[model samples]
Target: MSKVTGDAFNFSLLKRVMAYVKPYRATFVWSVLLTLLLAAIAPVRPMLVGFTLDQHILKGNYTGLVNITILMLVLLVFQTAFQYAHTLLTNKLGQSAIKDLRINVFNHITKLRLKFFDKTPIGQLITRTVSDLETIADIFSEGLIAMIGDLLQVIVITSIMFYMDWKLTLAVLVPMPLLIIATRIFQKAIKVAFQEVRVEVANLNTFLQEHISGIAIIQYFAREEQEYKKFEKINVRYRDANIRSNWYYSIFFPVVELISAMSLGLLIWYGSKTILNNPTIEPGIITTFIMFINMLFRPIRELADKFNTLQMGMVGAERVFKVLDTQEQTEDIGTLAPQKLTGNISFKHVWFSYDQDQEAAPKYVLKDISFEVASGQTVALVGATGAGKSSTINILNRFYEIQKGSIAIDGVAIKDYQLAYLRKNIATVLQDVFLFSDTIFNNITLNNPEISFDEVVDAAKKVGAHGFIERLPGGYHYNVMERGATLSAGQAQLISFIRALVYKPAILVLDEATSSVDTETELIIQNAIDKLMEDRTSIVIAHRLSTIQKADLIIVLDKGEIKEKGTHQQLLKLDGYYKRLYDLQFSSVGIAK
Candidate 1:
């Protein structure tokens, strides 16, 4: 994985991130009003301190001091109440915004086509969904609170300072420009450093995930040491990224503190000199000036830290929006229309390739090919690796579109049908079967919610899965781990077959269904499949020719072109590609049996 960079934070990302706040406008407005009230009330404390200094301390007016002190206490109570309300409002608004963003990103991901999943790493996607989202929540909650409150407090303190004495106010803010420049510099460095940190974290997650999933193969091959070395390289980069982030924060805080301290010192010196020369400048006013400076600098200090966090959040926002911005594979024009298609399928003069740069690559994964399967007939596609068997199946299923020519299902153009409608009518069992981490019943029924429990069990029985499921500790209630890691590959395949059986689609596509199973398991799966295919139109993509011997038609592919097409007996008589593949797999079995 490549390192994440600061350029990921584009203007478009910010625009999208801001869009989440629109729904929570009422909550945000209340939060802002409360925050402004708190800011307006903040200056009262310093004014009260000044009153005590002049009336009680300087003049020694005890009777007046008591009233003034009580008023100050009352204002403090109001300030505390405003703070409580502000916190509640902002927290409510922030959390609601996060919920909206999370839902939007999730919904977008689900709508994306299979091709996006093929290219994007699962770990990176998970990072965007979980960790990055949490970071954005922090930015919305704490970062927004700090930034908005700081700016408002600064404005309030400045107004109060100018009212006390304009000359001293200008002097105090002499260091403001320097502070802004310094903050800008820190922000630039922090953005770059945090981007590095994000990259390292994503890389670490991907590395760990890959290694854990492949642990069995790594151990069997005795490649543990090699994998360990590889992990160390990524771990070291993560460490370095973290250290760099720490370094940025470390330098930034001290410089910001120094600037704040220097400003206060300059303000104190200038205010005292002005008061000494002009006796009308009461000691109370000086006290208030010092108090205002303190309050002002605190938020300023917080602003520096909050700004850094916001920059990091922008990086996260960019990653999430990138996924949202991806183009969906194709528009569904069918609108879930019911076509009630017959089983007949036709591939007309089809030429296909996956490459976008077709001119330079000039590589057609499937050259001109045409075939037809009549309703309820079985067509077997057999070939060596990269011979376009799976490609043909994918095209027929509308998983992809061909470069030239058309595919028609029951005389209707496949493109005219919605993806959901097309897929709903077709069931495919791939060599690699994926089962969710759910109960056996859910896995078989795919948690349709509409499919009843009895129907699921019936489907399982048809696929021979019910027999072993009954042997499990919980029978149909047995829970499968992620990707069915708890079961053997053959068992997973059986469960997949049962899932297809339950759907009972009109057209069934089996891509090497029995290729990975042992002889006994193969027989169980084959028997179940034979029963499942009794009336449905079935297309089987197989390497072992015996599996397709019963097929009404077998189309043999060689180097992206069909070299032979006929029944098993007819192909044997032709003495071509089909006969050769048949000889390789089942010739010995034929003699032994």
Candidate 2:
């Protein structure tokens, strides 16, 4: 968010932006040719006017005047045609390039590790993908190609001016230095303002996205007025940033107009004296010079604004490339893409930390944790909040890498197997279920071609969800809406269970999956889970001791380290951490332990 003071006409960033244009180079080349044609044809009009005035108009030659007029009309037609084609080509090329860039950004984001998402805001990423990249499209359509055309027009106009009469051209050029100084100062000030504007835009997007998504909480807490004031603060900053940038434009444009007027006055004063003193200098030359001044100053005036457009484009490019350049992706270098895996998992003296800075003294969330689950075995993780229960499941699924030791499935290192293959074989059912704004069937199969509709129905039936699902309006095709808002919490949990069931994963990880349901729903889920555990190696994280009483092994954790490990009866006999937890839970619920 720091103000960018560097040169806005950044070549390196420009080059990166052009790499996407390689596929559309043919259109780019055609656009450039048209631009050149328009520039070459521009000065011809004024020259023809001067020619007709001096050669035909002055002598009263009607036939010659008619011929010159016809030629001028033809030139105008060609210029218009070239302009139309140039605009079409540049716009076409701009859209095609940005489409590819947008896809690339989306692809990159999908592959990024969960750790990156844990730290970055979703809103900032949305701005980079949608709005910021949209600004870059202007670089091709309105900024780069258009600026080139304007610059060539200015150069050609200036050349023609000096060719006709060098002294008059020199007189007209006297005011340009002042304008140049003003332009430089304006560019510096505007770049800073534009950066501020961009920063505020991101902030506003983040605020709106967050508040809207959590509007229920805000309303429930009765914080609408407070939230509105916060939004007002951000909106005010956005307004001020835009106004500041506009203020720069307002001042700079008037100064340019004034400089243009001064050049016109200088031209008329000098030309009038010369025409009076010297009879050889024709009136037509003054008229042509006037047109040249207009031609020259118009582009010069527009060039500043277009330069601003180009700068805004570059600013967007800088932000986008920053996302593209991030290397925080989980390196899927393992070539082994195994088709099937046994339900055996092992963690050997594993150490992990979410803190990415290795140089600093690392704060590990899981310390020297070691465990094992054989094929068709059920292991439950029991702990209070922040005791690294979820961390265990996350690391087992390779969502985050461990700092020390190795994780393996069926004696093969987890990293040695392909990332997609490993993840597909391990299904996770989180406590808070997340369903897409899609049909029930799509959410169940997740669009997996291998899983047929029959398979979805069978999976749902096994989880006791088919009866309720068929009772709904659309049955399996019913729209769950966003995050399953159309369904009850227990219904959503059942759907998630069905989702995991169809995957037929070798390893199943449930993070407090049954802790949020009513007694009847829990009984239904527990029965389904019992059937599921007969084949798959299940890892369950739960605070409820009763739900995991039948697990083959319960590993109790406190402050990240293993405090106790045994079966329910064996741990009770030990009179240790597990028995204390069991007592505490039963006491809270008025059950005599």
TM-score of each prediction? 0.93, 0.95
Those runs of model 1 whose alpha carbons end farther than 4 Å from true positions after fitting are: 1-12, 61-74, 544-546, 591-593
For candidate 2, the TM-score is: 0.95
Candidate 2: tens digits of C-alpha lDDT, residues 1-593: 22224453578788888999999889999999998888889888888898889989999999999999999999889888889999999989888999999999999999888999988888899989988998899899888999999999999888888888999999999999998898888888888888899899899989988999899999999999999999999999999999999999999989998999999999999999999999998888888888888888888888877887788888888898888888998879888876678778888998889886888988998899888889999999998888989988888778888999898889988888889888888899999999999999999899999999988999888898899999999899999999899999999999999999999899898899997889898888988988988888999988666657879899999888889988888998999988888888766887555
Candidate lDDT values, in order: 0.81, 0.88
Query: Residue-wise lDDT of candidate 1 within 1-593, one digit each (tens)?
Result: 12234434355555566678898888788877887778888888888889789878788888888888888888888888887877777767767777888888898888776657777777888788877887777666677665887899999889878987898888888888887887777777878888888898888888888788888899999999999999999999999998988887788778877877787888789878887888887878877877887788778877877876776777777777777777765656765446476689988888887664556765788888989999889999888899998888877776666788888888878877888778878999999998989988888887788788888888877777788989988988889888898899889999888888777698999999888788788888888878877888999987655567789999989888988889888998987777777788778776431
Worst 10 residues of 1 by lDDT: 1-10
